[model samples]
Every structure is written in structure tokens, then in C-alpha cells.
Target: MGVCFSTEIKDKSSFHTGVDTDGNDHSTNSSKVSSVPPTPRSEGEILQSLNLKSFSFSDLKTSTRNFRPDSVLGEGGFGSVFKGWIDEQSFAATKPGTGMVIAVKKLNQESFQGHREWLAEVNYLGQFSHPNLVQLIGYCLEDEQRLLVYEFMPRGSLENHLFRRGSYFQPLSWSLRLKAALGAAKGLAFLHSAKTKVIYRDFKTSNVLLDSNYNAKLSDFGLAKDGPIGDKSHVSTRVMGTYGYTAPEYLATGHLTSKSDVYSFGVVLLEMISGQRAIDKNRQFGKHSLVEWAKPYMAHKRKVLRVIDSRLEGQYTLEAAHAVANISYRCLSIEPRFRPSMAEVVKELEKLQEPKETRPRRHSSHGTRTRRLSSGGLAAADDAGLGAYPRPQASLPSK
Candidate 1:
């Protein structure tokens, strides 16, 4: 992780201006689109509602400039995502076919996520409407092609900020970091606090996209599922998700639950604090895995200073670091009951900023304000690296 201050100094002004107390943004549309709120439905029920012909392939290809190399936004197990435009033939927006940027996720012919996963995305991103969740504009399923469209996220993924190395990892200011955490927590809270719990099976830095203002939106619903209930213990399924972030218990057994998400979130919080990936080649033996390495240190705040990223220096509050670290430790607890709900996580994260009431009566943080990281930087190499990070508090793995 090499998010260098030296490289980003030229763009520092852009970063500072993002944290305004003014909730009013010049670009935001005050006019709300009135529509009947989607009726509540389980994941399966929502999946059934995706209408195939709503988005034509011709429109998608045209909007994406025939999936031009430059139009590419991101990629995943699903497929390449391209920046696309609105046709307005179907929805008839004011913009019509011009200047309207949307992200088009075209599914690979033979993707690991498969058809069930596509349905899952349609189900969640389709029905859910929250500021913190990526807005799924629509999708296209014509013959073999399966494409998903989402609102364009200007700043790219959270992974780009936390662990991508060089300028990408350039230390985020304490304020922006807290803001990102709060936004992500709000999205997860919206998911888990619903009458039905939806487990985000794949919650990692790469899936958390940022707009121009550094606000986070949770994406990648292909792996999400309804979390366990009753004494059901865990929802069993084939193991999936990125390495270095999967929960130990779920990895050991197919059994999954809402707490699995909590564990993944703990890993994410650790990444934010340390400015390091969970596992990087730079780490010494026994310290390579962030979960195993940091457990003991997080349990004791006296060692907290050792775990925080050196790049931060005096920028962050030590007390704030300890508070968030402790919360992460609990989130990663072996027992599901010990883990806090997403709503609780959101509340704790909100406390990191200040009292919600403290903002000026008029200008509050409402719409997004993103600061772009400088694009070019060294991704990784053998570590000439930062020193040690401590372990989280000792706790037994659940049976």
C-alpha cells in the first residue's frame, strides 16, 4: 500500500473541497422522480420480475460505442462494463441519447456467476433503492448476451483507494475516510435491517464504487443471498468470493449467515485503517494474513499505534482508530450473536464524524462530493514496506 502524499499534492485542493458542510450541490437534481415504490419481496420473488425486452441489445451496443476500449468502466466474473448512454426510446428521459453516462455490465458467455447469479443481481439492484447502493438503471438479455446497466460511478472502486499501491493508496484524509465508511455502512444497514436480511456474500473493496465525491455504493449482487434465520445456523452453499476477505468459519464449512458479512466488513474496516491489503507479498511470514496478524493488537489499544498505517503519521486521531478497530473485531467475532447488526454498524460509524445535529441548519452533507485519486502509480512489487500491524482481541472460533 503506497498511497503517497507527495504524488497527490497537486490535487490536494480537489480533495479538501469535497468535505463541504453545504448539503446543496450544484449538479444535483432537486426534482425527485415520482414512482410507485417497489413492493417488498424476497430475493427469489424479486428475481422473477426482470423483464428481458426492456433494454434492447442494439441500444446497449450503441450507447457503449460498440463496447469501445475507452468506454470500459470495470470488469468482474460477470464481464466487462462499459460506459454507455441513454436511448430514451424506452424511458424517454430529457437527455435522450446524449451525454447520459451509464455503466453497462455485459456478461461473459460462460461466466462463473452463471444465470442464477444474474438473476440475483436483477433481484437486489432491481428492487432496492438507497443512496448507498448502486442504482441499476436496467439490463439487457437478448439471445446469449446478458448485460446490466448501472449509474456511472466516476471515482471507481474502494479497492483503488485502500490497497492498490502508490498514489492509489495515498492516505485518505481522516474526514473522507470516515465519510466513506459511513456511506458503506448505511448501504449495508439498509440491506440487513430490512424486514428480511440479505447477506452480501461478496463484500470487498473492489465492489464498493465511489462517485465524484468519495461516497460509497455497494455493488456486485451476484453472490448475495438471504441470511439465515431461526436456529438454521448457516445457509449452506458452494464457497465463493475473493481471497484474504472470506470469513474463516464460512470457509471451513459451506454454512453461511449474516455474521459472514460482518466478518468481511471487519476486513474492510481494517484495510481503511492500515492502508494495507489483508494479504500482500510485503508481509512477513505469520503476518501475511491480516486477520491472523492483527487480532491480538486490536484486542489491546496500547498496541493500536503499531497497526495504523505509517503514512497517516499524526493525521488521524488515535482514539478514533481504536474505536473503529474494536468495532471491527466484534464484527469479525466467531459467533454470529456477538456480531452487531448493520444498523448498529452504521450508528457506530456515524459517531465517528460527530453528532448528526452538529451540522449547520441549512448546509448538511447530503449529495456526493468525490475527489479523484491521481491515476498513474506503481501497483505492487516485493515490499520495501511499512512495519507491523497488531492482532485483534483473542476470541475462539465458533463450533
Candidate 2:
């Protein structure tokens, strides 16, 4: 596991000054394009450096049926994502579903903030490839238009399946939820375990997309940053992420490490268990923060069951829930030092996949109960690495 520090440092000026009280960032469009000098390489050179496919705007337009509204898959601050089609071999435009399906994300030309994010997505996804990570097929930058094309994730974002309410939504079963969690962990583990570790600063349910077979893939590299190198323990950067999922330490101080991603993973795991948003304004005042509200219950064996999603009442085995909750608790330790690395997390979760008869021996924790948790639980590891972590002083955002 990575090291951590809890010393209270002087607060820095707000890096997200352009962000509104509601957490919406307005800086993307405020700055002029020419204000910031271009890098040494030209735009074309930059794309070439990544060895990425640069598609003509005309090609993408035809693929998306001329950007018809009916083809839209999802829309956000960046722009709308359209369901499109292209030839599998030559990448030519094709009739919808008659050839390879693609998701074309067109950026809103007016939003300057999205340009940097768009380039970051292209550069990173273009350079890295993993089964658990979303695949960027190509990009189009023509005139005032900026866009990205990716392999279509037929099932869409995990956020929709986890929180969106409607008849179209079918609650994910226990096995499926575990599979998604494990896949996402592997994605993060791969990034953190890379030669030059990459910190996925933004880790949330919405960033996890699903394929037709229910396989999970991590998407969106807009806020990802390179980890600290040499002797440096952490990297200092401007705060950026969704309201509820940001780590308390990272939120208080701009210092970031791999543990920050672990903290975010814990929040998403909590969401999977309780079927609740990290921060929901609709919830009562004290109950608005899922992590805060769920913590008390998670500490107790009987009460922990209360936090499980009501939809999954009879679906999962009692032992599996206990194991998952234990992992979440460790990942969410207030002190980063106590949190296990993504690799360790993968091992613990894999144990849950084994049949009951072949499972590891049960172990006792803090005299709470004798729970069988993958040979030995993370609770023991925390005992060896625990450190003090000051509680965050910032009031939780209602959004």
C-alpha cells in the first residue's frame, strides 16, 4: 500500500473558482483559445504523436445520420453522445447496425474547458489499451467542431442501471454487481500498476460503462493525472471530481495519490450495496451523505444488512455481503495508509468468486464476529498500517 500524511497544511486559493456552488464548472468556455500558447507541437503533430486515427468531420456526420437528435445516446456538459455506425474494415460510414457500431461524442464548440478534456481523452485512450478500459476508436477536429469516437458500449453507463429510476431499468443482480465491481477494480489496478502510474482522479459510477454482456469498462480520462515519481510521496494538483465521490484528504488538500482512487472506489462500492447516490439532496439532512449515513450501520454485523440494496434482499449469500462490506470498509479508511492497493483489492474480491466449499477459512475481527473473509480480512492489514486522518471540515455539497 502507498504511504499517507495527515498534517494540516495551509489552505490554498480555490483552484475551481469557475465552479458554481452547485459544482458545475464554468471555466471550460470562459478562457479564450489563443490566451494559452500552443505546445511545441502543432495540433496535427499532437495527434500524430499519439498515433491516433484522425477522422474527417464529414465521415462522423454521415455515421451519425447527420447528427440527428434521434441518434443521441447521452448528453452532458461536454456534449451529446450519438449512436453511430461505420464499416468494420475501412471505417467508412455504414447503415445503422449493418456494420460496426460506434459512439461519437461531439464536443460543444463553445465550451473551452471541454477542449483540453477532449485532447486528454484522445491522448490517453489512444496510448493505452486494456480489456477493462473503454476503447477510443478515433477523433475528429475540423473547423470549430471537436469530437471523439469510441467502441459502442451497448449497455451504456453503470450510473443509469444503479440509480436511474424507470421501467426501462432492471436492477442488477448480485453476481452482476460483483462482476462490475471486480472489472472496475482491475481497470484501476492496471492504471496504478503501470510503468508510470496514472491516477484516475475522477472515479465514479457514471464513468463506468457496460457492454452488451454486462462487462464493465472505465471511461473518461479528462481529469486523470500522472502519479508522483522518484522520492515524492504525492502529487499536488487542483481539486476536480464529483461532489460525493472525492476523497476527504484530496478535497481538503490538493495532494493526490493512488489512495485517492481507492477512496472513490469505496464510495461506488457503497452505492452498489445500498442502491443510493453518494450525495443525494432528496435524502433527509443527516442522511444526505451515503458514506456518512452508511458507516454506522456497516460497523455492525446485523446493522450492515440494513445498508444492502432492498432490491437484493434474497439474491446474495450472507457471507459474500460480509466480504464485500469488509473490503469497502478498508478501501474507505479515513487514513490513506490503511487502504489497500488496487492489486490487493483484486485478490480479496476474487476470493468471493470461489464456491462456498472451496472458500478460505473464516477469521475473527475486533471480536465482532467470526466471519469467513478470504483466508484473512483486510481488517488485519489495517491494524498494521493505520494512521490518523483528520475529518474534512468542508460542509458536504447538497448536489
| TM-score of model number 1 | 0.74
Candidate 1 per-residue lDDT over residues 25-59, each given as its tens digit? 22222111111112233233345554433577887
Per-model TM values vs. the true structure: 0.74, 0.79
The digit string of per-residue lDDT tens for model 2 on 183-298 reads 99999999999574888887887778777666789888766777888899998765667678888898777678999999999999889888888888789999989999888878
Per-candidate total of colliding backbone pairs: 16, 2
lDDT of 2 at 93: 91
Off by over 4 Å in 1: 1-53, 87-97, 167-169, 229-231, 355-399
Off-target runs (Cα >4 Å) in candidate 2 are 1-49, 167-169, 354-399
Model 1 whole-model lDDT (C-alpha atoms): 0.61
RMSD over all Cα atoms, model 2? 11.4
lDDT of each: 0.61, 0.69
